[model samples]
Target: MFRRARFAVLFGVIFLVILRYYTTTRHSILDVTEGKTSGPWREEWGHPIKTKQSKGANDTVHDESDEYVNYLRVLHRKHGFTNDVPVATRRIKAKYSKPPLKARPSLAQVKNPLFKDPLGFTRARLDSDNIWLPAHAEIPPLSLPIARTGPRPSSIDASSLLFGISTTYARLTYANNALLSDWAAWLTDGRGSSNGAGLVLTLHGATESQVKTIRDELHHLGIDVTLTASAEGETDAGGRYAQLVQQMMRQRHREPDRKWFALVDDDVFFPCMGRLLSRLQKFDTSETHYVGVPSERADWVIDHGTAITYGGAAIFMTAPMLDTSGQLLCLQYTKTSGQTGLADEEDPGVGMAWDEGLSECLARNTPDIKMDVLPGLFSPTTANAQTNIDDVQRGGGYASGALPLALHRYRNYHRFEAGKGHAVTSACGEDCFLQRFLFKDGWVLVNGYTLTRYDGGVTAEKVTVQTPKKKSGGADSKGAVKPSERLRIVDAEDVNPKERYALSWKGKKKTWRLLDARVKENGEVWQAYVNRRGGGNTVGGDMDDRRPGDIVHHAEEEKSDVDSVILLIWEGEGEK
Candidate 1:
């Protein structure tokens, strides 16, 4: 029985030892996969080191079993216990010289099944096993290369430019109308004109005199004036006026050669002809088909009349823009359809509507043709014509003034008259009519001073006076003083030739003298001398026995000698 019991005990001890060894090996494998293992079990720096078991103890122990077990577990996880792992290890030939630095496969190689398959399958294996190979090829080539190009040239003809003018009936009066005629003539003459650009006179009604004057003036200036008379006897209402003007423009466009047309009013004036031509010349007819002189109408106060459009009186239209065929649709759209409320009283005149209408038409039909408002090119003078009482008071007043560049509410009777009763100096006369118009259109009315007079309507008369003065003895008056010979004392200093003058007294000499005297008179000069220290007495007594403050006269003497001199003196006590 004792022998059997000892055998059982031995068997149990062997089983327990085997169980502990298996658990230890499994634990080591877990530690290595979880990155908790040290020494050879780690990815790099795998060599094991000897160390003391406790913090300060001098004792040490061999840990080769633990390290060896960890290494075997790592090998099992990486190589799946395959004979290939052992063969790969032998082929690489692990050496004590740095263990090959544990090189990682490149992305290309790792992505390729032949080198990177975790199952150890090569490209040949994929092919034989009917597995689809993934592709890593470059993207398909792009279609083709395109070449770059430069901007295209403008199709506009700079030679054939046209301009138009806008104005009301009343503003173009006699003087203003004449001024406009003169301006047109100047422009046509090419001396101070728009370089021979075609001139067109657009008016509300064609008066016989206005037409004749404008025609003659424009003819003289060398401008071919096309007088576009408004439809006769038509009432100014609704879009009818604008429509009629558009129709007229369409008719004018029939002539394909007419390049540009400028919109001008009868009251508009041009100050510098060179500046006007320069502005018209720089116009980009190719790109911007419609251009105008911008004007401010919101703040514009027409004291004598009504405010017109916000745009200046002048507008220039290119030839191509007048080609109505291209803008037919846009024009049709602009035409009122069944009483659209958008067409209100604010709608500009027919010509103005045509100008603005062309902008919208070109924008929609021919977008390439831009619309620009030239800066500082035209000025609206009508805005300046709305003068207040204060302006007249400060400026003294005006008479027969030059016509403004433009004018509002101009009447035919406002012309300057020498004897007319209505000659109150204000800005609203016929003179400012043209000035105001041209000013509103951005065409600066330069030389404004040359156009009008500052003072007018006043008259004057001539008068003569004589005064007696003491004269030197003549041949007929031996001992008898010749009744204080008559002398003429003229008030020549009244003109105030010198802006300022000074008077001083010499205390030491008891005398006073005039300095820088600009005297012009027919009389003898005698200065008043006073001796203030001698009891307020007067010195340099005169022959007339005049008091100190009394007038002393000197007259022309016929005698050759006798010291023909006279002096005047005054006495004062507090002259110090």
Candidate 2:
């Protein structure tokens, strides 16, 4: 009996020992696995990537809860009262948004089994929602060369080109600082007067104090301004004061070397002055030239004759044309809208748009003088700001194949500020923005716009880049083709060049549009491209109804977190 009892106790002890050992081992394994994950672990442990040479990628990890909070910090540092705010108030990131502002907060990581390798931060239900967040701005490689922005390289006299813009004091004070910054970037170096091009500002109803405040801002920005105000008008949008030619002729007369008076709207953007001078130097400055780009809408163009220079596209009038522009003093634009495509039979105009009236008056005087449509100048009238990435990727009005001469309706059609996007020019020089480069990893970089891993593994060898259906040029000195409702611009669905390139592959492609760009003290341009669809989180469809504090059991049930960012750090100067 005693021996049996001892045997039973020993057996029981053995079983207990074995059970304890198994439990400890299992927990240790789990502890190690959990330690390998957790959000911040990605910084220490590099994840393995697997992608096909041509068209396949697989990634199953991302961050769901945390996002890099660099936007607010940047806003504070750039535009906020930096001098008044305490040092603690300057940053949204803990100790990260320091002087010179590198602006890259670390991306936290989570698990997502649905995505491929190249789409590190992309959500699975991309059809439902997507977002673009600011990533990192590392100096980009200097392997490829694009045109740079600097002083005039050629003997072309850029001083002959004088630019003008008309805006109200309220409009000029509120939203035009960034735009005026863009102007300064193109026309002047940091101290202004880099290219010797002049800028004339016609504030519609600015008070003396308002004008003084703006002059202070412009002087600090390095743009020497030829500031003036319009005569008392009925309305700021349009009126008898819209007669700008007489006032502009006075400015034109002030400069003996003035060859062209480029009267542009407040939104017109010149990416590179050298390119503008080159395009203009092609034409005879002595001739009576009425130069502009037609509106994108065929119906609008038909309503306003194609011969009329669209104001936003800029009215580039040569010296002789400026001389004649003064004669149209009779064709004054007014508050009461006038008839389209006519100028009161060459008398004081009532309802016509200033640009249209000018065309009517000029056509009446010199019947042979034609409207010279500037090549590569785009005026996207029917575009939305949110779809700028898709529009450019597919080469809709946002053609990246060629560097633009001037882009009108900047953030109106495009999402980015012209100044920020053009910052790369300081390092890469002119013509670098929106330039394309394909990489071995099946990714492509559209300089200053997007870095993309296209669908169907579109590499340099496989991809065929085609622009949107070429917009028909303006009709000859005659009127435009009968207004057609059928004329639709190239961007129909979400446009990514890959979609247009691979007709066979119908799957989705991914893009990381530029979210933040800034110039460092060392002259490097740091650009961060995030995988968010900007404008809004959802791309094509509407969002689902949701309650607060809900825990999702499956990955597919939750919105994708912005845990991925790609960086393109450009060296301050490219290798010559």
Model 1 ranges off by over 4 Å:
1-161, 165-173, 190-195, 202-223, 233-258, 280-283, 295-310, 324-342, 345-370, 377-447, 450-576
After superposition, candidate 2 runs with Cα above 4 Å error: 1-142, 145-157, 190-194, 235-242, 294-312, 332-350, 378-395, 459-506, 533-559
The CA lDDT at 536 in model 1 is: 12
lDDT of 1 at 69: 26
Cα lDDT of all candidates, in order? 0.28, 0.46
What's the TM-score of each model vs. the native?
0.31, 0.59
Candidate 2: Cα lDDT at 90: 7
Model 1 Cα lDDT, one tens digit per residue, 37-155: 22110023234433333321321223432332233333334322322211100000001112211211100001111112121111211112121211211112111111111000111
Model 2, position 258: C-alpha lDDT score = 79
Local accuracy of candidate 2 as per-residue lDDT tens digits, 1-576: 999999999999999999986664211111111111111100111232222222113322123111222322332232211112111100101011113211111111112221233223322211111222211222122245332333322222467778777776776554435555666666665334446677777776677888888777777666657787664454433333244565667877778787888776676677766656766676788887777643232203433322223433467888888777666644454445532335444464444555655655666776676666553433232222223324443334443334565666545444445565676776665556665555444555666665555456542223433233323653323222221222222221211222221212223455555545655556656565544321121221333222232111112212223323444556665554
The clash count of every prediction, one per candidate, is: 65, 28
